[model samples]
Target: MPLALYLLALAVFAMGTSEFMLAGLVPEIAAGLDVSVGSAGLLTSAFAAGMILGAPVMAAFARPWPARSMLLGCLMIFTMCHVIAALTPSFAVLFATRLVAAMANAGFLAVALRTATRLVAPDRKGRALAILLSGTTIAIVAGVPAGSLLGTALGWRATFWAVAVLCLPAAVGIATGIRPAGRTSLGEPDHEPSLRAELAQLRTPHVLIAMLLGALVNGGTFAAFTYLAPVVTATAGLDPVWVPVALMLFGTGSFAGIVVAGRLSDAHPRLVLGIASPVLFAGWLILALCAARPVLLLSLIIVQGVLAFAVGGTLIARVLYAASAAPTMGGSYATAALNLGAAAGPAIGALALAGHDELAPVWVAAVLTGTATLMVLPSLRLIAPRAHRVAPTG
Candidate 1:
């Protein structure tokens, strides 16, 4: 229950809002900048590229620094990027700002995950991370819709300005709440963070499977989530208004799922992952098959969201668990793996959309998650909380 952890979550909320708000504003941004919707959509791609590439690199370079300093620096850079984006009238400038902002976002996520674990006891790592990731799920539920409303009432640039302003309290809170560099809220380590030692963890069986599980599960989640608008309205034949409602429901389910996973995973990590993974895949399969049924489609989306995060979030925690010896790189591994899934999932969905219908994304999601279920056996041991870890003594 550290103040710094909540501050970090607050910062994530702002960044997560910025990351997803574009879904609602793409048409407005396209019209304002005299670009096609297709072109504007590439901004999402740029952000994903930055996150996928920047996370490991940023974590590696900043590994030696205090997590508190790294977290604050990333927040400042993220706020500045939003300000520049809000001021820019040109598409190029806006695109550049998003790419840079995503890098800062990646850095914050990597450091924050590592720092969150350190702030609490070893056994409560899952809960600590769940608290931090709640910012993201809450962003999905409220922030994206609010951003769209703000854009409609004012303009797209207003949303950007709002994101910039949102970072201010987080900055101030982080500055005051987290103690100074040495032995701050970010408990000091016994030695310098070694990037080489971190990379060596990749060869470990538990770490590798955990990363694979995260990538596949999260990829499926993103594939379905990215196309929810079309799946709900166009495929299920619901009204356009159902789009936002559906998103809210999904986000609500996500929040519930992650919280449940956090509360239960420490005590029953194997049971949580074992049940959530296959169930998520089955949910996707059912949705894909019955996508035309309005009632089923509506009901399954929430279930899908629940299973998605329950499985995905727990796997991410396991990655950190298996790589506990490599604290600095553990966060990087989780960040990079999830970002990789986020990048690939949407691309697969886009390809499906180009050739097939909106429901194709659901099918793609099912396949991705089914593959994840197949890979679960190897990851079972690594996903559990350590039964016999000894506390560090002075």
Candidate 2:
């Protein structure tokens, strides 16, 4: 809601773009570097792995610095990584640059989420988070397509250069719009989180369940989403040019879902997951069954995007609420689970595709979503014991 929030979101947009833009640029990068596409795909995997490992490390070690400073530092690191990526000639150097870029992204997201949650009214925390995170969805909408086009027109190197250019405006905006430490009551003084104590909080069954559910759902979603372009083109018979348009539709649905999910989180975080998980499962099922119809398949993808994304904010907020003892550590683990899911999804989907055709991946995704729904049931029940009493009845 505040100007600072949008500035933070803008930074997130740039970071998110840089992180995933590699997926579109992989073929071009592989060709330029005289490597196979499979090898170039490693660039994307390396980024996710970096996020998986670097997020907690950054959160734990950088706990003493002010939030704004951390964010600025992250942006600088990201900008430098992009610059190196653009200028580097050797494939090894380019790969290393991507890894560094991934680390910067992980740090930025960890701090950005923390800052966004703290910046809003207690009752509006969900909406605030959704606003900030929509930047990632916005990247899927705008960044991937633009990156792909840029890669096609100029070169993959030019796309990296474009990201570096975008970071300049993002830095300036963050500096201008963000409140300095001690300026806003919401931006409290830094309190170093105890990693040991935070790890101890995992002994709580609810927390464990939340982590499991987060990983499962995220892995399932990414498993399907990572390969969406091929699935739509090969199975649904859509034009290749339409893949980005379909992805844009997914992003639109997700962005809308995020706004509504924020309101539902404040009302009933636990129940919202129950409602959303089923819809996500159904969406996958429909996609699997109607694989021959481009229109029907795209419709299902839209629904999947909306319902799946709607639960994200609610689930993360629920994890934080459940882990009242040490939110920072809890927050870090939640993000770690998310990254783990991101890593797992594609692997599982690739396995599913090994012995079958394009439509086979949809079945795998459906199974994963269904399993995730089942895994989440106990935790959802634990949180909303009264069925309807998901939030404090104030």
Candidate 3:
């Protein structure tokens, strides 16, 4: 992988940390702003909503710009938003800043993925994407926890300040490491597609299916993951302290899973999805059935993490591959789909939890993942006949 790829990953790490760190700091923010915990929680929802709406808009507007310029602009905006957020006194101001930050974050991710894919060979696009996405996994494993700890020690505002500081290096790295010409192939500069042409690409059945698959995969994983703390503690009868340990194990599994999936995706994107969907469904089912068994629950959580993330690179590669005619919009749509799923999963999990069963989220996840599994074969079949018609673009 090129140094530019790692620079993109560094940008993702900062964005991912900002995206997730809010979860741990909600109570602090609530107390600081004199709002209810539920009110403070709206910040997270706002960010997701921004990502859901902002991605396609950003992609459309950035259609004519070089990918590197778009990325740098997004990072600069993201960094400035965080600084403003850190200084804001009103909860409303903080919420607005987060929303804007998320928009910038969405733009950065869409452009970064497009840029990374262009930098590598067609066959190595999967690994390039995986390397870029690994930043998010690393953020989950280390950054979120570190931010939580920093919040506890120095205040939530300080954590935001730290994230702002972190963005500086990523901005510098992108500016220095990625050459403008490296953004796309020589042919791409002359054949920039119109926004209409890009939008038309989404009408492709395989492209739509790939987006749907991305949504289902993420929705299912988060549906269960969102409520894991309670399930592990109350349902599994595990010590509350062990919850963090379980989460770390899950993150570790995700890191490993994405790397393995990246390699598999190069030759067998469909195979990666096919295997991951079933394994994730089975893992969730096992968790639902054995929630009361501490040992079994713990083991299943790690296994489920691996199975869940093993499909990440494949899902991403599939979307990009399917929409090779309009890579930027395709990548943006994929980001939107994933964020939509992230937002939906918790809502679905909340509905399942209304039954007052701690294990209900696990069952819900299993059903969603199983549905994703069912979509895979049909999606592949649809893509086969059209594969030759679609021209690859960056």
By lDDT, the best candidate is 1
Q: Which segments of model 2 are wrong by more than 4 Å? A: 183-193, 383-394
lDDT agreement of model 3 with the native: 0.83
Q: Write the per-residue lDDT of candidate 1 for residues 279-378, one digit (tens) a residue.
A: 8888988898898898988889888878898888888887877778787878888998889999999999999898688888888899999998888855
Model 1 misplacement above 4 A: 184-189, 385-394
Give the deviation of candidate 3 from the true structure as CA RMSD.
2.3
Give candidates' CA RMSD values in order.
Answer: 2.7, 2.9, 2.3
What shift in Å separates residue 219 of candidate 3 from its native position after superposition?
0.4
> How many clashing residue pairs, candidate 1?
0
Ten-residue segment with the worst summed lDDT in candidate 1? 385-394
Instruction: Estimate, for each residue in 185-269, the C-alpha lDDT of model 3 and write its tens digit.
Output: 4234456567788888888777888788888888988888778889889987888888777777787888888888788776766
Evaluate model 1: give its lDDT.
Answer: 0.86
What shift in Å separates residue 306 of candidate 3 from its native position after superposition?
A: 1.1
Instruction: Assess candidate 2 and give its TM-score to the true structure.
Output: 0.93
